[model samples]
Target: GSITHILIFASGASKVPLAGFQGTPTITFLEPGLGQSLPTANTCSVSLNLPMCSTFNDFSEGMALAIACAKTFGIA
Candidate 1:
């Protein structure tokens, strides 16, 4: 029903966060802005990346995350 947690990726950025972050990250679920460009989830395989983002929003990140989760969980 919500993102239990997540790690966002930018182009040319590190894929993994630092070893341990015990605190839950405070994040904002921004709605799609006016014709904003969304990048493909290149941080990992689509299957491994998208589902982590789907439920909270309906933007490009959500699409990418859903694809990744479906791939990993086999629930397309």
Candidate 2:
């Protein structure tokens, strides 16, 4: 099966915003060097705030989002 959803855990210091492409709430990544582009076909991406050296409590948000995403895509 193909990947339907993606969850990205980025550092709090990163400048990337926590939203989808063009503020539409659709997750995507772009990297010209890697021959990547935005608006991945049939893919939903989400990025959560996660700082380095964080505790378990800090993982709650990401985990919650992951579950929600899974349910949204009927994965859970």
Best by TM-score: 2
* Alpha-carbon runs more than 4 Å astray in model 2: 1-53, 74-76
lDDT of 1 by residue, 1-76 (tens): 2232233332222244465333332333334443433323343331122223344455555555544553443225
C-alpha TM-score for every candidate:
0.21, 0.26
Clashing pairs in 1: 46-68, 47-68, 50-64, 50-65, 50-66, 51-65, 51-66
TM-score, model 1 to reference:
0.21
In candidate 1, position 58 carries an lDDT of: 50
> lDDT by residue for model 2 over 1-76, one digit each (tens)?
1132232222212234556244333433333345321122232333432223244554445445544444434335
Which residue pairs show backbone clashes in model 2?
A: none
lDDT of each: 0.37, 0.34
